[model samples]
Target chain A: MLQKKVLPRLDESLLTHLPPFSRLERRQIRTILDQATSRRYDQGVAIFDEGAQADRFYMLLDGYVRVVRITPTGEQVTSLHIPAGQLLGIAKAIGRDSYPATALTATESIVLSWPTRLWETFVREYDGFATETYKTLGHRVGEMNTRIVELATQQVEQRVANALLRLINQTGRKVEGGIEIDFPITRQDLSELTATTLHTVSRLLSGWEKRGLVESKRKRIKVTNPHALVVLSQG
Target chain B: MLQKKVLPRLDESLLTHLPPFSRLERRQIRTILDQATSRRYDQGVAIFDEGAQADRFYMLLDGYVRVVRITPTGEQVTSLHIPAGQLLGIAKAIGRDSYPATALTATESIVLSWPTRLWETFVREYDGFATETYKTLGHRVGEMNTRIVELATQQVEQRVANALLRLINQTGRKVEGGIEIDFPITRQDLSELTATTLHTVSRLLSGWEKRGLVESKRKRIKVTNPHALVVLSQG
Candidate 1:
């Protein structure tokens, strides 16, 4: 069960920095926020499930999300990891009435959501909404295309390396050693991300750890040598 | 060498049925056509190359286009096939100044293009333009997601089967024996699409031919038994 917390007037400043709201006036931003309700979710909570009715759409205000898909045989694949200040569950943007994939929280997160009925109104009335939304969609499509090419042409090792590089680039935090993927991601997650087996992922990670390429412990991974991983990914 | 053909006038009916133009008024449609130049591309002609300047965007009025991507190692992969009545070279929509992939003509094609500068105007002025366009991008993303899942979970035979089914669904034409893929797709192309070796693709197709599931001859293929393919794809 999930609980929605009543928002006591979302501040317009909260959205001014976001790309989709950057061009809108304060009044416009206020109007947009007025229609939204905010909620807090714990890490590992599912925000939505695949094939469920897309009655609402959401924007992540804090933390990370894992976009997951289940194959026909019921195998789970982690399709994407989305950072904060991004929209999710926009099935209307994709011309579907049902959610296409499941969105799970990779970290404890805060989110604001609006009824799906207001989607078209927002697109039409909001100044930068459509352009920014489409731009985001385009970026996702480009990423998917890159992943497709990787799957088709790259080896398993290269695929895994590229996946790590992508995660670090998207949500890496600088630590003492290097850049740490700023969320809890397990070896099974990496295997799903790279389309490789868990044993293969374990073997490769162990080898890379020995070579001082990465450090993994307790479901967390940090890249100690990103340049080496880049080189490995290029092959 | 490429040649641009001047149009005396573009018929409004030519676009009335297209999704992007369907919601525009007559004068609005005329304004759009006025900004566009029509061109005829011969088979195998490259409409746009990856990483090249995206100065213009186009819509395929007739025939087909193949979206190709070259890997870092200079290997060609057929990423997608676009049928007529669809948009291509939409780099601007993706926030890209350069095309992300090369679009090659699968057959002699008629295309209408406008300067990239007009993309924003179209979205702003034309009703349903942004929505329809994003919907199309969403559909592509969905397709790419499916492909990624197939690559991750399916065997070589299953991947090949899904690829054929996708092609036939997009541009298949009913023929005497069954439905023929309307484009000239070689086994090498199938190999690229499915991320398998040419030898494996040939072997699988031959085995399927023996089983009366498909017919391949002279750079063309026909699905003789789609039901069997659905079964094969499920596994």
Candidate 2:
């Protein structure tokens, strides 16, 4: 049987700076720390499965977690990547009994988790916590709505360009030539993100490389000319 | 100058019955009603334009509003529709200063609006209200995530079928023949919703009609064989 007591202690300051928590008082923050425990996983491990009981939620401490949904035929599509210092497994906050998607480790990862039962307690007790959580939800919704419109209206090239821009914006790291996506994202992941095929993504990347708009090798991508990519995305 | 006092008095029960409000106390409910005002718009009129200051937010009372985003070249794509009893123009809740998308009336509409300045007051004073609002935000994000995955994974026919099923679930009315989408949704609207073209939508609907799976005329669509549609969407 698993035991909370045996878990290694973690710095409480990690929770204090995260949004929803940044709104909580020192005492409330301590209460959350008391209820939380830390865990680490190797890359490619499943943190939780789709349709599993969402009895708990997690906040990342280090590394990446890819959120994915398995199609009826058992094919996995990458939905989004969760980086360190953000929350995942939030299905319970909206009163769902099961997770809508599976969270898989994309890199060696550390996460701090809290039992779902305490979700209501925090919402009831902390205004900043509730407001910030809701704000995060709203922003995500808004981003998806934008994607829906883009999918309906933009061409494949434009969609690919926009998806790349979004990925870079979310997790890009400053580099000499330009910004790198800051994670290992395969071509198939970009295809899934933009609703295109791997072949199309490859062809587009080849064209962009020839034009010096971007540079890619294996799973890494860097925007060599972000302004041009932005222009292309607008079309 | 637009005067809030010139608006017609709305039944406070409209706010009382809505989510977030449904969770608030009677006194709190009265306070919301005091700060609110009713407004009306004719079909095809813009309620709020994209990039406009989001000084207030709205909840529908009657008719429909279509959320849209205009592309760089002036193409308008329908993002989603808001039926009576849901909130719109909620940019401020997420900390944005301007509306992200334009909201236009799909039919003659009545709405109750509250100033954005009071958003914090409500969240701070009423925990249930904040929770419900966040819950709504979370649910919307979840739905959009589902749509993104479907767009990435499903074929056009499957997407169209799923979109119809979703619309029917949201606002269907039982008819003698089948379940009919309640609003006057044009084929163009269906095209936008499903990320297909008008020609493709027309062809699909025509094929469905010949097979008796659905009957669509003008702007109305009735699912004559929901089971078959479901099966088709599963593909």
Candidate 3:
């Protein structure tokens, strides 16, 4: 069973800066918050699983979530890494009755969720809700299209480089040596992200480490030379 | 030049059955039709090109369109085949200023288009316009995700089989021998769609032809045994 902790009441100010709530008045934001329930999840917790009935939608308030898809052969593919202040498990927005992918917390995170039944009311009554939600969905579609093209045209090495670059762009933090991915991501995760085998990922990372292009140790990856990776990805 | 020929005023009946217009009342539909311009595109005509200013969005009223993307190395990839009664060039909805891909007519087609400036008005005013439009975008995203998984996990032959199956399901018509793709699709197009070389596609199709799986001649392909292809795709 998944572990969760119900949080205290949410404040409207907590949501005022979020894209989905940014356009609403304070009263409207309060109304939205009144309908939401906040909870905290421990690291590595699966918030929802693919093919499970989607009864609620969430907005991450604190940490990162990995959107995962399991193939027919039981191979796990890490499709996306979602950050704080964004919505997740928006099955209703997509007109799906069940979650399309599993959401797993990469760090201890806090999220606010609303029952799926209120999705239509929120879309119709809340100003800018539907527009912002659709915008987010459109952005996701664009990213998926780009990944499809990359898989269809680019070489494996290029794809791996692009995947790292994308990760750093989304969740990078400046460290002493270089920019480090802010979460504990394994080589196996990299392989899953790039659609390659762990052996290939290990080999490539070892080579990159020797060349000083990146540094990897203990489930952590830091890009020492992002420009080099960018150039490699372009090819 | 795009060979422009502006036709007479559009009748509201032309849009009643389309998803974007289905929930709209007759007068509201009339208002929408008043703002749209209908034009006929010849086969192979480019409706929009990638990176061009997205001044307008279109609804395909008749025939089919091929969504194309050219990689950095200038290799053209056919990402999708869009059939009639669907919206295209929806850059505004995606928060984009330019078209992401080129839309090319696969057959002589008719399209109704409106200025991009009116997108926000339509979304906010129409009862179900945003809901339906986003639903379509969500469906496309789902399709893109499926293609991504197929590219990442499936073998070359399986990918080819799945692509053929998708096309047949979308635009196939019953013929004496089997079900034929409703458009003239060349081997080159199949190669691009499946992310393989044309020679490989030719060899595979030839092998399948010998196995009584499919028939290909003069840029037309018919599935003689979809069940066999389905089984191959599963593996």
Candidate 4:
């Protein structure tokens, strides 16, 4: 969970952490960051909602954020979780003047909000801004490509397995026995994320529990044999 | 289809064709274009392959390109067609270091290629470079989002109708009888694009042809009732 004071310091260090920004470019980044505002959110608080106009693009100094799409039944399909040092908003930052997805604080989060116009200005004046943004763009497109393949090619079981593996790889917190998903995600959330029925997930988890592959509590699961789990995922 | 000479003078003017590029930004873009090398691809040439390492990025000066992926059974899925004025080799330009999809020229095409490192430099040094790249990134991500929604929410009939709409909207070439898809495409290609089977596509086309909604020959299909098709798509 992200809860820290990170937005107050308008420094080149944060700017250089992303691609293509050198120390000199960091000075210009400082100029831009100085103009930014700081914001914090408690766990489960929404940073922004779907369709919000792109006013500010936030850089996470500390904490994690979740991007989700709310279904008709009020179910949230967790599309992705953004940890520290990654960008928080881009759809609105680049186009359509809108936030395409909803953002919620997964932990205590500290964020720096720059006037969306500042991003535009920096993009105009700084080469680092544009290239870094492009790199970010490549990543977003790659992700969507993977998701399309998942939806079109993989079945429910495979999708769930891959999703869990992805979570473990990207945002898992190591424990004594195994790795726990850093976010406090529920089975229902997992079901929506995989586009499968909750009943199916419940059954699958029960089976995995008995097989000593995973341990599930009310809203958490600890992966045991990650490699074997991946082999099962191959099925 | 795009067929134009890659003249450096066109860089400033190309900005006029797209929105959001200020006059000064146009000049900045020209610098990036100045580094580009002109290349040509004959019809049926493979510009890049799916899963291949992406090393360079291309901008179409002239000709049509088909972006495709191959399945395990050797079936090909037509992902998208690139027209003139659009950038190609997106995965490389965006820094994936690999081609996400293959680019196959439908006709002889003129493309401008930049050294992968130079492109990275431009992304880092040129202001317009990063913003333009981010915009391109936004465009691809938005396109993929539409595909995800279509795959999840739309029925097969509606999907076909929407695909026709998309084809017409992107690259429809009007002929004597009606609107023909700009490239040489088959029912099988259409099936792959819409994620349905060829037999189902054949049956659907037959039904539409009977209703005068669309007409098909050996490999071409022309839309007759564009509005009616829209209604069908909405259904």
Candidate 5:
């Protein structure tokens, strides 16, 4: 229904840079864009909830969405963040009956969505799209395998160092001191990320700040010594 | 090519139960079976090494394969094990240039392989195959997300309990004592799976045995009280 009420067609040019679409030829991109409906959300809005019927999936045109899951203990953990030009809610597109996690907009965001019914049609028509999409999923599984290994073998200090390094790699902004994480993340978020307590994350950041290895203020973090962090993460 | 070596044709009926193949029609299954090559490996043999050039992916016909990744510190960790009827080395078939982990035969195994080049051909021709394959990958990603959350938030005991339950669900055998994990898996494997230490896993298993929660000897484990594990994993 959103498709029928679209104000104006999304620029076909934006589709050229997204996965599945990026793999599409010009005409194939046009065909998909014709069926897409664009929507915007305010920062901190829930895009979809866990256990919701998975009828559609979204492609981010701008901004960020964080995937959060509530454990059996009722603690919420943000598992991953989706950046611009990437797809989310892919479980539905691949035949899952419901979403496994809640997706919340981390910032004011724009997303282009398509009904799940069209997923097979696109795959049947475009080999590149399906291949690229599945490849992305495979890469994610590989990354999580690495994280599991890290959590299993590494010390808390090392885990924190690794988490910071990964964050910087994914969304770092170069600054005078070093590379600052480009997202608004708190110590609580860092704690959830590194499998540590908030106190532990705070202490580690403080110690790193004292050594000029990192700079932190409020919700922001900057890795001042990337090499040192790498050395520490290796432990 | 293995298919041309005439080692005898793979059983077409087995293909009907495996993914992608399972989604295919009888005629389509025969078409794919014609291109598949059956090979056998001895227990502990390396099926594929991490970083090897992508060429082919396999479907297990018998036995198991353990997916192992070596850390930057030279520690090898077994990330997961794939039992018969599941697919492996799928990254290559989905556009990745190389295997992300080393896959070793956990037991003497029979596998049917298809060259990566034919992946696109199958997807373009078979909507069922593509949908099923991508669905499998999506399920894997979802599983990993759950593991990541557990590692990030759950305690070591809880994680161990969760891992054991998951393994039993995947490959449990009913026994007089309880539900036994139907595979050869050592304490070291348990340690790696739960992100704990060998000593810790040993100690925890011993403590659980004293409490009549589980029974273990060498590489085998039996859950005498599955309900306890469920409660523990929830913590």
Candidate 6:
């Protein structure tokens, strides 16, 4: 069965990283992409809201967005930040008809949204696309498991540190002095993102600033000592 | 898009519950049944451990099993105790090569463990299999979301009531006096399942026993005043 190798030649780099889309048959994906439409979202715009009917799949072209779940008490908990080149609104595209969470534009962004039925076409005609999509689903399941563990076991301090490290690792840019977080995120926003109270977050930031691990001014945060931040992640 | 109708039948009664498979699709699933190899476990048997390489998925054939996770401090937590007909060890079957949590036998039981690769093959080769599998995945995602909400907001006592309610919903048996829990589970196990200490669990159980809301002795528990239990859940 392995030798049959009916699947198309895969891009080696993608196979080892990201979803298993590396194995996709190129011609099939090209056809689907030809039918997709792109649009732009302004900063602070609602890309979609919780309980909204899910009917389209979106792939980001530029900028970033936050996927958030609003608690019953009206508190918003940020689950993930989606950046350019990543897919959003997958539940809509994957056959479900309701938005799982609200998507808020973190910056002005370009996105490609395709009709949900287009996925059916891919699954029926393009084995490679379906295979890759399933692989993406698998990756999401693993990620959720990790989140569940963290939510269940990790202390608030560790969760906050992990959130900071994740933001820096994914979107930090090096400047003349140190690495800075790209987004104009506030401490209250960071508190919601980490599922902790703002008071604790404020105290932690103050502590970090005193120790010279990070610098905070206005709406910006800069990481002066990545190694020190890692040590703080000790659970 | 509404005319596209991904699920063609859309029957009120069936979709409201569970839909029947296409005849050919049922046959394919039956073949998975043919390949299924059953194993027996006596009570208290540890079926798998968290962080173990995920290899196989299990379908309970008889009796019951409990899903467990151990904290960093070596405290055991029981996530769920489920009976026959429900799937177990599914984390590995979808994509993970390793199991996420430990499973223990709640009673003398039979389970069918299948190679995950083979399950994937069945999902691909069989028509409508992918559709059904995706539904299962969606259902699990919904269940996880519910767990997340509970962990985030619910008190420990509320959590225990909810846990018992869930277990009763899944596997309880009707008797002359009340609903039998249908599994031999101790208060310690209940504590683990609810993410609290055993002493707290014992205290709650004792309180319930005094109120005649439940009957408990050693490893047995029966819900007598379900309405009262619901009040406890609310309070």
Please name the candidate that would achieve the greatest DockQ relative to the true structure.
1
Fraction of native contacts (fnat) of each candidate = 0.72, 0.63, 0.60, 0.46, 0.67, 0.09
lDDT against the true structure, per candidate, is 0.89, 0.81, 0.88, 0.73, 0.80, 0.69
TM-score of 3: 0.94
**DockQ, in order, for the candidates?**
0.66, 0.50, 0.62, 0.36, 0.56, 0.21
Residues B1-235 of candidate 6: C-alpha lDDT, one tens digit per residue: 1122223322232212222134344445556555656667789987778778766777676799887777666767565566676567766335556776789999998776676767667556766545655665666665555555566556888878988887787888887788878888888788767767789999988998999989987888899988888888865
Error of 3 at B42 (Å): 2.1
How would the candidate models be sorted by lDDT, starting from the highest? 1, 3, 2, 5, 4, 6
Per-residue lDDT of model 6, residues A1-235, tens digit only: 1122122432233222334234455564455455656566778788889888887777676788888777666777776777676767777323467877789998888666677766677566754555566555666555554455556667778877877888888788897677888878888888877667888988999998999988988778898988888887767
Predictions: Cα RMSD each: 2.0, 3.1, 2.1, 4.9, 3.0, 9.5
Tell me which residue pairs clash in candidate 1: none
Better of 1 and 3 by lDDT: 1
Residue-level lDDT of model 4, residues B1-235, one tens digit each, is 3334445354566544543234346566677556667777888789889888777777787788878776554656666767787777867556578898778897788787766777656655654555665576567666666676666556889888998888877879888767888776688778877888889989999999999999888777788888989999877
Show pairs that collide, candidate 3: none
Instruction: Indicate the worst ten consecutive residues by lDDT in candidate 1 chain B.
Output: B1-10
Question: Which of the two, 5 or 6, has more TM-score?
Answer: 5
Clashing pairs in 6: A54-A97, B53-B98, B54-B97, B54-B98, B54-B99
Model 5 lDDT tens row, A30-118: 77888887888888888789989888887888887778888866777777767787788877544687888899887788888888888
Extract clashing residue pairs from model 5: A152-B195
**What digit string (tens of lDDT, one per residue) describes model 5 on residues B1-235?**
2335245654568888776766678888888888887788888888889999878887888887888888877777777767788878877544687988899987788888888888768767875776676676667667777878888788889989988998888878899979998778889888877777789999999999999999999999999999998987787
| lDDT digits (tens) for residues A100-128 of candidate 3 | 88999999998888889999898888877
**Candidate 4: stretches off by over 4 Å:** A1-34, A69-78, A92-96, A120-133, B1-44, B51-53, B70-78, B90-93, B106-108, B117-133
lDDT of 1 by residue, B1-235 (tens): 4445456788888898999889988998888887788999899989999989999999999999989899878888887889999888888776778898999998999999999999888887888887788777767778788888888899999999999998899999999988999988888888988989889999999999999999999689999999999899877
1 against 2, candidate with superior DockQ: 1
Q: Encode model 2's per-residue lDDT on B1-235: one tens digit a residue.
A: 3447444654567777788788777777777777887777878789899989999888888888888888776767776777788888878666677898899887788877888988778777875775676566556667777777787778999999999998888888899999998878888888777777889999999999999999988989999999999999999
Provide the TM-score for each candidate, comma-separated.
0.94, 0.88, 0.94, 0.80, 0.90, 0.81
